[model samples]
Target: MTESDAATASLRPTDAIVLTGLRVRAHHGVFDFERENGQDFVVDVTAHLDLSPSAVSDDLSRTVHYGELAVEVADAVRRDPVDLIETVAERVAAVVLAHEPVHSVEVTVHKPDAPIEVPFDDVAVRILRGRS
Candidate 1:
């Protein structure tokens, strides 16, 4: 199959297209030191929906506005200090699900600068939500 054919084939009415590793700085952690000394956070978002409208119309309006969604996630992460990445992920997923077009949402919050004694890349939490 050609590239265009593959692209089309990959899309489905219920398929989810994921945006990963979206880095944002936010104060999230259980330690008091972490909340006080804010650190960089990374987030991944997956939006599940029907892609047929955007696929056919080739119009931005027919699809979930990823740019707007990114901003919303960032804003939610920064709004109030959280003590855990789990809480951040849960909140972000809730916010994304509020968008009507999104049938389901998955959010992952990563904290690279977690206050662990051993060296580590990061710690993260993942949460999933779906419309009823």
Candidate 2:
């Protein structure tokens, strides 16, 4: 395996949590109509934490509560008026990393129905952040 692959493979089995397809209506875009009209945005997050404690203790307190995290992300996305998905992804990552259990997070913000002259499937931005 490559060095990075080997390093990732060495981590424990339950060390990460993934949340996907979190859709919300948010007012973020470069164009005025986009901000005014608002559009649906989808977020997918992978949070890295030491999940062994939760696994062994069988305690919810030992891990990040994904439902609450999803709501937090949705609420944040709905309120912000940012111009770029990159900014949205960064903001979401910061929130996830704020959790005590989370050591790092990867956030992807997908704008599937973005405005464009030509046809396309989707547009998105992804970012990775580690606790500091």
Candidate 3:
């Protein structure tokens, strides 16, 4: 599919797998400590694809293997050091959408302990990408 196709693959109730609260310690930030000392980043991913094939065959191979997908996401998050959460989210989305069944990806990166001077509960960046 083209970029537009992936971009327009809106989430539907029937064919989506959601993973949430997958926290990992990663060095991603604009400041020195962010890369050097690192921090906890919480990732939430929604993978959109047709589940009918898997549903009919009752085969794990027919669907996205979320267990392996989670590992790939965590590795992507913790391994590389980026200055922006947007990049991080994109990387995660790329991994999720790599599967043929996944037409689109939704990634949310949470920086709860962001180095903000103001008092706040959390900060996060969310993005959606379609198959490229």
Candidate 4:
């Protein structure tokens, strides 16, 4: 199947997972100053899976454990300080895909206090990852 077809097939209504507003402090940026002085980072994640097992078993182990996923993202960001938010977003996506039963993942990383010279609420990077 084509990539688009695979992506469309993964978006099953019954299989929905979301991890929102995950706050972490990480040093990530192009500038040296930004790297030295870490800043708050926010991440939002969505995972798609087959929820039938979880429904039948009524067990948390049958589905994705979002709390563990959140910790993994935080650990990755803290351990691997990159030079750009794009890299951070990609790394987070990779970590999520490494988990079992995750057919597709979407990650959004937000930098609330960016070093931009202009005024803005926040800067963010969003990426979608799926099984190939």
TM-scores for all candidates?
0.83, 0.87, 0.90, 0.89
Candidate 4 local Cα displacement, residue 28, angstroms: 0.6
Candidate 1's C-alpha runs over 4 A off are: 1-13
User: Largest lDDT belongs to which candidate?
Assistant: 3
Model 3 clash pairs are: 6-130
lDDT of 2 by residue, 16-130 (tens): 8999999999889999999999999999999988988999999999999999999998887887599998888988988888899887788899999898889998888887777
Model 4 agreement with the true structure over 26-56: per-residue lDDT tens digits: 8888888889999999999888788789889
Count residue pairs with overlapping backbones in model 3: 1
Q: What value of lDDT does candidate 3 attain over all alpha carbons?
A: 0.89
lDDT per residue as tens, model 1, 6-79:
64544323766677888787767788877787888899999888878888999878887888888888898887
Return the clash pairs for model 1, or none.
Answer: 29-83
Q: What is the lDDT of residue 112 in candidate 4?
A: 94
- Tens-digit lDDT track for model 3 on 25-74? 99999999889999999999999888899999999999999899999999
- CA lDDT scores, all candidates in order: 0.80, 0.86, 0.89, 0.84
Best first by TM-score, ranked: 3, 4, 2, 1
Task: Candidate 4: list runs displaced more than 4 Å.
Answer: 1-4, 7-14
**Residue 128 deviation, candidate 3, in Å?**
0.7
Which ten residues in a row are the worst by lDDT in model 3? 5-14
The 10-residue segment of model 2 with minimum total lDDT is 5-14
Sort by lDDT, best first.
Answer: 3, 2, 4, 1
Which ten-residue region of model 4 has the weakest summed lDDT? Answer: 7-16
Preferred candidate (lDDT higher): 1 or 3: 3
